[model samples]
Target chain A: MNTKQTNEMQIEFDSKSENEGFARVAVAAFLTQLNPTVEEVADVKTAVSEAVTNSIIHGYEKKRGKIFIRCIMQEDEIVVSISDKGKGIADIKKAMEPLFTTKPELERSGMGFAFMEAFMDQVDVISEVGIGTTVTMKKKIENSSTFRVSGDELNG
Target chain B: TGEVKRFLRDDGMIKVSRSLKEIANKVRITKDSLNGTLNREPTLEEIAQELNMEREDIVMALEAVGEVESLQKTIYQ
Candidate 1:
C-alpha cells in the first residue's frame, strides 16, 4: 500500500551549470493542483529560479556541489526547501540583508531574500559556514472552493 | 509553481539604526538611476502609455530603481 498523505517530490541537481528554466517548469507542473493564476505561477517560478541560481552560483561558488529541492503540498499550503552541501554562509543575517550578494560580478541584485520574503507567507534560512545552507519557504493557498467567504462571491 | 522562491534584491534601510527619517530618505532617493535608463528596454512613449503616468513620472520612477522594476500594477491585474 502507498501512504501518500501529502504529495511530496525531491530533486537532486549539480550546483554547477544547472538549467534555470528546467527547474521552473518542473515546479510549475507539480503545482498543477493549485489552479493558480498566471501571475501567481510566474511569481513562484521566478522565485524558484532565483533560489536555485543562488545555490548554484553563490552557495557552490562555481565549484562542484549538490543541491536538494523538496516540495510538499498540504490542503492549503505548499512548502519548499532548497538545500546545498557546500561552503555555507558565514553570516546568515548579513547574507539576508537586501542587495548583499557575495558575487556582484554575476549581476546578482542581492534581492533574492527580499523577493522571497515579500511573496511567501514565511521564509527561513539555516546555514553553517563550513557545511551547508537550507532555505525553507511556505505559502498559503487562496482557494475559495474549499471554503466560501460570502454568499455574494462565487468560487469561479 | 510549487518550488518557487521570490527574489529580494534591494538593499533597503541601511540607516535603520540611525533614524526613521533616514530610512524614508533612502526609500525616496537611493535608487540606481542608471538601471532605469540602460536596463529598461522600453521607450518613453511606451512607458507613458502603459503606466498612465506622465513620461517624466515614469522616468523618475525608473531613475530611482536603475530600471523599471515593474511596469504598472494594472498590467498584472
Candidate 2:
C-alpha cells in the first residue's frame, strides 16, 4: 500500500450554504486515495461541513469572504485543516461548548465542535482574535478495520 | 460518523429490508455525521475504530439509511 500522500489543497469560495456542500464532495473525492469507506467519508465530510459553515456564518458573519481548506494524508490516517481569516473567536473554549452560540438568529446549534469531537479522534482548534481560526483534525484508517457492528439485525 | 450505533441497511445500498431495531438504530442518531456528508467537515477517525467499518462502507451505509428514511417518508399517503 502507498505510504500515504500528504499535501494541502486550497480553494477560495464564497461563504455560502450551497458552496459548503460542494467543498465537502470535492475534498472527499480528492481524498479517495486513502480508500475511505462510505461512512468514514461521510464523517469527514460532515466535519468539514460544520467547520466551513462556522467559518462562513460565525467567522464571516454571513458576509462576503473567503474560506480555505487543507487535506493531509499520512500512513493509516488523514488530516484536514480549515482556517478562516475572518473575525476569529476570542474564546474557542466557550465556542466549543455544546448549545453555546454567538448568533441565535441563524439558529446556530453550537454543536460544531461537539460534532467534530464525536467524529474525529483528535481535534485541535487554534484561533487568534482579529487573526484567524484553524482546526486540525486527524483520523486513522487502521481504526476502521476494528469497528464491529454489534447485534446488527436486518429484516424485511 | 457520530455514534453510528447501528446501520439498518446492508452494503450501504438501500434499506429495502430492515427490522424495527435496525431502523431505530440508524434513525435515532443524536447527530447527523453520516447524513450531513454533503458539507465539508473535519474527518472523524474514531468511528472507524468504533464501528469496525471501512470509511467508504460507512458513508454508503449512512447514505443508505438516509435514503431509506426518505423512501419510507414518501410512501406515506
Candidate 3:
C-alpha cells in the first residue's frame, strides 16, 4: 500500500456562502486524478460543502474573511484541510455535539461537523478563540487502480 | 407585538416551510430505498428522480428543513 503523496493543491477565496459550491467542486475536480467512484466523489463533495459552509457561516459569522483549502492526494487517499481566520469556536467539544448551534437566529443546522464526520474517514478540528479554526478531513479511495496505472505509465 | 404580527402575516413563509419539511421527509425515504436498491449511496439527482422532483428543489428542501429541524430541536430540548 503506497501512501506517498502524489499531488497537492491549495486554494484561497473569500469566506462567502456563494463560494461554498465552488470550493467543493474545485476539490472534487482535483480528486479526479485518483479515479474515485461516483459515490466517493459525492461523499467528499458533501464533506467539503459542510466544512466550507462552517468556515463561512460560523467561523466568519458573515464577516468578510479568507477561507483556505489545501488538498493532498496520496496513492489511495486524499486529505483536505480547510482553514478560516475568524472568530474561532470557544468549546470545540460542545460545538461538535450534534444539534448544538450557537446561531439559532441564523437557523444553522449544527450538523456540519456531523455530516463531515459521517462522509469522511476521519475529521480533525483545531481552533483558537478569536483566532481561527482548521478542519482536516481524510478519505480513502477504495478502488483507484487507474492512478496506479497512470503512475506506472509515467515511470515507464 | 411586532414579532407576533410578522409571524401571523408570514403565512406564505410558513406554508413554504411546511412543504419543504414534507419534501425532506420524502427525500429521506427515497434515499434509503435507493441506497438499498443501488447498493450504494445515491446521488441527489437519483433521489430526485425517485421522488419525481427537481434536483435543485430537493437540495433546497433538504437544506431548509435542516435549519428548521435543528431549531426545533434546540427549542424543545
DockQ of each: 0.02, 0.08, 0.03
Q: On residues A1-156, what C-alpha lDDT tens digit does candidate 3 reach at each position?
A: 975648889999998898987787788767766656445666787888888888888888889999999999878789999999989988999999978888776544677787778778999999999999999999987756435344343211
True contacts kept of 3: 0.00
CAPRI classification of candidate 3: incorrect
Which candidate number would show the highest DockQ if scored against the true structure? 2
Ranking by TM-score: 3, 2, 1
True contacts kept of each: 0.00, 0.09, 0.00
TM-score on B-chain, cand. 2: 0.32
Looking at model 2, residue B16 earns an lDDT score of: 32
Can you tell me the CAPRI class of model 2?
A: incorrect
How high is each candidate's interface RMSD, in Å?
A: 15.7, 11.2, 9.9
Instruction: Compose the digit string of candidate 2's lDDT tens values, residues A1-156.
Output: 865445556767887766886677667755555655655666677778789999998888888888888877665677888888889988988988988888766643676787777667888999998888998888876544322233132112
| CAPRI category for model 1 | incorrect
In candidate 3 chain B, where is summed lDDT lowest over 10 consecutive residues? Answer: B66-75
Could you give the candidate ranking by DockQ, starting with the highest? 2, 3, 1
Q: Taking chain A by itself, what TM-score does each prediction score?
A: 0.84, 0.83, 0.89
All candidates' TM-scores?
0.59, 0.60, 0.63
| Model 3 score (lDDT) | 0.75
What are the lDDT figures for the candidates, one per model? Answer: 0.60, 0.65, 0.75
Question: CA shift at B41, candidate 3, in angstroms?
Answer: 9.3
